[model samples]
Target: MTTQYGTWRKSRLSEANGACVEVARSLRGTIGLRDSKAADSGPILELTRREWTMFLRSIRAADKIG
Candidate 1:
């Protein structure tokens, strides 16, 4: 299925060196992720809201443990 993302937001931790990913949310509650540097031509990675939350939780847990 094809989904369209409206607005994309980049992480505050993103550097000025153009190495970062942008994330957007669709009306259907799906999350869209893509490269910030190549916003137009890059491939997008889509995930469900639950999956996105789990992914973020894992990253946060890893940060706490490490």
Candidate 2:
């Protein structure tokens, strides 16, 4: 079966300098994410729903963490 990659959306925290990450949805139940700079060269990280939530939590707590 062919895999379909959905449109990529930039993060709301992105700046005007274009330094941000793009995320896309794959045909499977995985989320695809890549760097905005080296899109094609950068490796994509596919994460499940649970993993994604955990990642979000980590990012939210980044500032609180030492």
Candidate 3:
């Protein structure tokens, strides 16, 4: 889906030491993720709502395990 990113937000995960990804909500049901270091490099990944949910679940599960 060709979506525009207007409300893109920088991740809280960003460190003063610098390694982070920025994210933006795109049109449709897609999530946009880009390298905070090189947004000009373009979005690194585009995920569907379901994919995003599953990914988040996996992260949560891993966090619990850790």
What candidate 1 gets wrong by more than 4 Å, as runs, is none
Better of 2 and 3 by TM-score: 2
Across residues 1-66, which tens digit of lDDT does each residue of candidate 2 receive?
544568989998888998998988887877887888888777788888789889989988996896
Q: Model 3, which residues run further than 4 Å from truth?
A: none
lDDT of 1 by residue, 8-63 (tens): 99988888998998999987889999999889988999999899999899999999
Distance (Å) between predicted and true CA of 30, model 2?
0.5
- lDDT (Cα, tens digit) per residue for candidate 3, span 15-59: 887687787777675888887788776546888888889988998
Return the TM-score for candidate 2, rounded to 2 decimals.
0.80
Among all candidates shown, the one with the greatest lDDT = 1
Q: Which residue pairs in model 3 clash with each other?
A: none
Q: Go through the candidates in order and give the clash count of each.
A: 0, 0, 0
